[model samples]
Target: MRTLSRECGVTDADNPWLSRPVAPQPSAPAYTGAPTARPTGPSAPQRGVPAPDRAALLPTIDQRQDADLWWLGAHGGAGETSLAALIPGWPAAGHGWPRTPGAAPARVVVTARSSMSGLRAAQTSATQWAAGLVPHVQVLGLVLIADAPGRLPRPLREFAQVVAGGFARTWTLPWIEAWRLGEPPALTAAPREVRRLVDELSALLRPGADGTAN
Candidate 1:
């Protein structure tokens, strides 16, 4: 906002009515304030700005639901849709925390791929849940979808083991060629592991903390 200042001319001693032209005064020395604040350390976030790690996290679903369990995706291609198709009526919250109405805690099973990046995303989600970033949310476990046709590389498998400890239990899914070919998961026969997942998740979907399924 550029405000226009009307500077009334200084009154002249010689003439009372007519305005007088004043000589320009010397410029004042610049008043320097304290040395510029050092850029905040990595631990300290800037004012009104979110931390880098927090900012990097994907936005969570805003809609609230009171359901048995939510498939919380770790990334964009975390296979939320296909899994949802397999278990019809279950809601999916992509890369975001699932919300439940009132004081009800959201029941979540984090989903991601078995690849390096996918596992990393899953790690972030697990870390967030472990850190209690959102209170009253229960992270039941993790479900790692096969990233390719073969077994995961040794490094990824090891890293996955580390990430799995963040949650209670972890489930693995084999790669489905039919899903890749655009076939609906619900129509195709689910693998034994997938069926086990469905059954175990169904049993573990209880809203109580005590006496959960193994």
Candidate 2:
């Protein structure tokens, strides 16, 4: 059978200008976009990567810590940092399951770049989560950060749809030049999409949330 990449005709030649991975970086500008694909349930057999030792990944946060959410990067440079910074109350875990002994499972949102490697890393994380390989965390959704300043390639978009099946929901962000230049994003100053995202995340993050998609 033809693979999604092959089906969509995505090849290495399509992504010739790849760069190093990093964490979250939100933008202060406006962008109405292809924000997400509703969950289609987890795809276990195809394109899933085996999970890692999650216990070793946790660094242990104090129970007294005030934060209520964690941004887990699916890979390095997935924009977990910027999203964490976007909401002052959240923190980013550099591609790990954030667990503290004696505490309830921490809430998390996985992030990745729109590039093939980034989204594949996200797929791996989501598949592992669905397979119960990741522990001590409730995944909120997947967030795909733009790797560049243009529309996503057709193949990547289609492949992203396949990856989105593993999570409760997913959100995508456009490439912000200001963020690339080291500018910070503010909820009050951000565009409508950012505001909407903040609102949705805030509601799901409230106490008693079961991490269900809105």
Candidate 3:
């Protein structure tokens, strides 16, 4: 009997269903794993390499005591010391916050000139105080010392307005020729504007009085 395979000339070797051996896949490369002995803390410098002084990276801030209020400079030359002397408050160097040992008042008056730059600094400080960024310090108000003896230029006046707008209370001091000449202006001889500032500050600092003054 003629078989179907013989009729079609099919062979066992030509059949696709025949089993075949597959080449083995290459072995995956082994991982040694990450180093387990990483040094802790700051990395050690190379031999003979001088280590940087970490302390010098930050500027030093001086803190002092005395007085019920602190006059902080919003920027350099903000007349903090002079205003402190005139206003019966502690003088804070630069913008450093006051640090008294015990029972010291946290009320702070940020001082700056009426110049554009000074006004900007005052605005930043007022915003920070309003946001409570300055720890343990209550911002009473802003004191803007006149940058010149005469009326502020229109631009500076506008800038001053922008800065004072952020604060609930603000005091502006007119330019004193004596102060510019390195002499303290006597309170009695002070201008009406200056006297008004003194009166308001005195009222605000009175015992059992809230920090705000009209």
Per-model TM-score, in order, reads 0.70, 0.69, 0.63
Question: Candidate 1 local accuracy as lDDT?
Answer: 0.60
lDDT ranking from best candidate downward: 2, 1, 3
Compare candidates 1 and 3 on TM-score and give the better one. 1
Tens-digit per-residue lDDT, 1-214, candidate 2 = 1243342233434311111123543322223342333333432222323343453232333333424667888778888887776765577775677775545676778888999998778766765565455556677787888899899999889878777655667778888777788888666666666566766676665445334422
Ranking by TM-score: 1, 2, 3
Could you give candidate 1's per-residue lDDT for residues 114-165 as a string of tens digits? 9888987886665555444655566667889999999888988777776665
Q: Give per-residue lDDT, candidate 1, residue 159.
A: 75
> Whole-model Cα lDDT per candidate?
0.60, 0.62, 0.56
Clashing pairs in 1: 60-96
With candidate 1 superimposed using the best TM-score fit, by how many Å does residue 135's alpha carbon deviate from the native? 1.2
Q: For candidate 3, what is the lDDT?
A: 0.56
Clashing pairs for model 3 are: none
Give the per-residue lDDT of model 3 (tens digit) for 72-160: 78888887877655543444545665655545436667789999889877756654443334445556777899888899999888767
lDDT of 1 at 101: 77
